[model samples]
Target: MASNIPSSAGRNRLAAPATPGAATTTTPSRRALSADPTSARLSASARRPGGAATPHARAAIRAIDQRRRTLFTPGRTRRRSLRDQRETPRDILRNLSRVLAPASQPLPSSSSSSPHRDANDNTLATVPEDDDDDFLIERPRFSLPLQEDEDDSDLKVPRSSGLEDENYTAHSIELPRRAWSEGPSRLGRESMASVRFSDYAGPEIQSDDVGIDSALFPPPAIEEEDSGNVMLGVGDSPERLDVEESRRQTLGRESLFGPIEIPDMGNETTFLMAPADSPTREATVIDAAVENDEPGVFDDMDDDHVNEPMDFPESDDEDNDNMEVPNDAENGNIEEPDATTLSKPMALATNRGKRRKLGKKISKHGIEYPSLPPGVVKRLATTFAKTSGVGKTKISADTLDVIMQATDWFFEQLGDDLSAYARHAGRKTIDESDMITLMRRQRQTSASTTPFSLAQRYLPRELLQELRMPVPVPIRASKKKSRAVDAEDDVDVT
Candidate 1:
């Protein structure tokens, strides 16, 4: 059990608070404290009928309160200066542009006070610099120390190099820079006015050749002759000359059909003109050669005689050249069709120019069935025999036809079955699942290893190589199975 009695040293330590720095008398009890409330005061935590606290309690509590002054106290956040807080992004960008902006030079002697400021340029307000240590974006320039010699200044000085001690000597702590000065802008805002239009082109497009619209059909040479070496002469003569020479236009049946009457013509130009209506055979050109010394001539005519005309048959006699075609059955004895004419519909004869018909027939069910030729069917039968371990065998035409019919019937039944399966699955189109199910049913019905044993057996080697075989269950092979060990000498053992 812990002692409730106060020890002498503890009593002295507890009693020391009665006087300033005095550790003589024992402390008054809690009842004495309550009775003499004016003489001994107690806090709410220490007021439960307890003795007075030790002499150092006030100093210890004071030290603790001093330590907690910062621990529980909220901190003071760093706030931006009033200048930065007031500055907007627009103000910042404008200030930064000064780094690239051309140095302020006195304007040229203009008639007006300001130099050519447009409405847009007028809208841009110049932002004032706050101080030398303004934001970096606002002051992005550096200057060199003033030099005494111009030749030395011409030499390039490396920037941000280790030799700043020589260039910058006065201010040891301050960064090396010339008093701030502006330079020409990199943004090229001065050219903004020119780029506003639609035809603001960049660099001129240059190629080895400018061939637009001129590759295949190159521009015709600007010379006299065309690409072809052909040159043109006069065109067809006009029916009538100008009023000055209106007399030479006469052309009549009398002049054309009359006998060769040569008119005298010397130094005067004359022309032969056909009648406007020329198809009526107004002139007869079939006559023996006749010559006339004096001949009428056109303005372009050569020395003329009555021209010799070749003897040709009369206009009515030319009808025999074109073959007569029978328009109806009543005139069936017309000329035969031309051998070179491939148009069967236009052919008059029934036998000639007919399309070569195939061995096709319509079934009793009104279905058009294409019959296989005897050659193909015989070849297929031979292939089937070859696959069945038989020698090449020629099939009879009747037997080949029967095989073809059976094949056609089998395919017809297969299509019906596949369509029925697709319909059962509520699909108009057949898919692989329906095919697998159909193949399974066929294998079950025929007791064959594959769905279509004959098809698989007779398929070409290339096709069989591409097709994958499907088995109901996978067969696991032994690790040591080799057919070479099973080889046997059936003929003889030597």
Candidate 2:
């Protein structure tokens, strides 16, 4: 048995070597081979079997593919099918009827031709139910007069109250009766003639219900003699009417005439209205005088005194002649005392000292004489005294200087008025009260001239209070340092 017989294992080994390129030349067994053919065929079919479908499946697939292709195509039957499917069932039924029904059964006629027809004539016409019965009840008709008469019969008549029982004559009736007696009356013949004229003038003559004559009414009339022209009411000529209307417009209705009374020509003491020719006469006479007289005819009228040079202390012969004295000098030069020493004296002699100093300084300096009258000087002195206080002492140099300058200015301004007052009243001194009044008058004049600047300059505390002008709130001093100190103390304590 061992003599040259190959085992099944050796046969397998030899078969495996025969197919060298296939997985190390492993050959399958007969049974494995038999099983693999059907599996391979199945695997091949699963992977890529082109003609393996059943007839029914292939038909279904074909149908689906045909439907997809048709659906994708433009203007295709499938798109038309989709549109037919989307149509309403009623439309479908309608289409079906058209297709299936006999030609003898015609479609409905249009609704516009028949008033009672619906959109489709096949629909029945709708009717509204009567609703008047719910809202309206039956009522018997009766005449208002009959109803009122019946009511009057049943109801008692009320007696009149005595409050309104007195007879009331209308204003119109009283007006005619009252007015007829006021004006001049015409004779009966004249009245009859006027009435006859009215008939020719217009229509029938009829009085108002209140007995007012129609002739009295202001209305236009047709003139029989002058048919071409229309006549206005009596007393109304065209020119007169136009003038009256113009007057009414220019002067208001109440003032139809010019001003009834003229205004008073005030205070003719100083002012006079010269005769119209007087000015010409005066001018001619003045011209004649000027022509007759020399060019310097009024040279002597200049009474203004020239200022003379002030005289200084004579130290040498040359200096004495050169030291010119002012012409209007009243006193010699007085040394200006020390400011501190002069304070009390200055306060006591504020008015007198101020005037004297100004007068002496002006005189010594040979300044032009201020023709200050005695009254103005007294007024300025009094004003200074009043403002500085009567008994209060210790005056400042600045205040004294201001007083002196102000006094000088005041005399210069009111020189003419002061001269008149002094000449008329025979007064030599001006007082503080007078000065204050003059200052107040000046302030009033200045305020009128320059309101805004005056307001700013004179914004005193009293004025501010009266005007309720707001005062700024004072800010508190900073407490930051104190707070810091307190914080430092706290830190130290802690």
Candidate 3:
């Protein structure tokens, strides 16, 4: 026989009819059976097998149920879109048509209908007969005198859709009427007065007190040609006229200080020298000699006349007598000695010759020095001696004098060198760059073993930058280091 089995045991049991109100024993689940020993013992007598469950499994089931409920929940807000926020062109056109439509259209008097009922009719009502009053309402606007070009832009319209057609017809038939009814202003008097001219016209505008009504002061009779040139008095001759015309036009007028007085220099006495002895030639020769390093060029020109005392005439009569030129034939040919010629030897000796005050302040050692203040020189000597590590040592007067002389010589040499550098650059004024250039050149010419050995210790930052030269990096503290090494060596030796 075939086995009697149900396809689904739980569903078949649920669907089966129950015997009337029978008392039933509670059935334990397989998990409950596994978890309790008493239930497990009782289930061992039963036919089916079962698996065990813990508290963690029940918690996982609860969490899964909560997630399912949350996933199915509805959103709090409705969806939004850009279309809802902006308008379409169709809507815009509709609004514009509504705004431009005529307020109402005239309707025929229907015997039974009210006027208010017809007033709410569509603006595109059927065209009625053209009555005179309706057409003449805007006739004043067209009858006005003013005429101007109207833009086609003002005349454009969409294809006569019902409302747009009515707006166009209304705008064309009833042009806006102006309320200004006054006549044009009376300006002819102002125009004529503005064109009239009087002699006193500007800030000098005259009061109407003179007897003449047209002008305060009547202008004198003056004649003019069409060329805008006025005719003055005629000249005696064409040449005289040309001269006067040129004289007026040449400088607008003559000199402000009357014609400048060019004195009679023709008779002035001038002593002319030969080209070889002229001042210009002498300067050129001196420059050439200096360039060639000639020591004798600077020597006294009149060696024999040097140290001679200058002699001036005792009286003005004697000077006048020397200056007077004798007209006698014998003496006329003989040239008198010029004062310049006579004084040149004295000038050369006084300027170029050696010290003449050699006996006044000469030391026993035969050294002659310039006059320097004793107190200042003494202080300088003390400072120098201290700086040189000769502390508290009394400087002898002769030594101070020597130091002063040496300092004076050093400053004089420096000034001369700076002047020579300025002259080489063809400038009379000495600038900061000249000094910097001289110092840089000096540094370059010297040996690389001594990099900081410049004539001047510091240069301006601007000059350094302009020259694209690096700022002077301080030399390594080699002096102190060397001194330290020396001290160490001395200690070792000791």
lDDT of 1 by residue, 1-494 (tens): 13423654464354422222221211332333335322222221122222223323333333333343323222212233333544656447657756545776434533232333332243344325432322223232243332344232233322232222232223123222221112121111111111111121222112211111111122222222111111211112233211111111111011111122222210011111111221211221111013222334221132121121211121112111111222222356433433212232233123112211222232222223444555676787787776787554667767775786676556556666787799999997986557657876876423223333334455766665444333322232111111111221211242
Q: Which of the numbered candidates is closest to the native, going by highest TM-score?
A: 1
TM-score of each: 0.21, 0.14, 0.18
- Per residue, candidate 3 scores C-alpha lDDT tens digits across 83-111 of 34446564466467567557744344443
TM-score of 2: 0.14
CA lDDT, candidate 1, residue 313: 28
- Scored by lDDT, model 3 comes in at 0.33
In candidate 3, the residue pairs with backbone N, CA or C atoms under 3 Å apart (3 or more residues apart, or in different chains) clash, namely: none
Mark the 10 consecutive residues where model 1 has the least summed lDDT. 244-253
lDDT ranking, high to low? 3, 2, 1
Q: Write the per-residue lDDT of candidate 2 for residues 154-243, one digit (tens) a residue.
A: 332233232342223331132221232222322221011121221212222232111122223322232232221122222232232112
Best model number under lDDT: 3
After superposing candidate 3, which stretches have Cα over 4 Å from the reference?
Answer: 1-375, 437-494
| Of candidates 3 and 1, the better by TM-score | 1
For every candidate structure, what is the RMSD over all alpha carbons to the true structure, in angstroms? Answer: 51.8, 53.0, 49.8
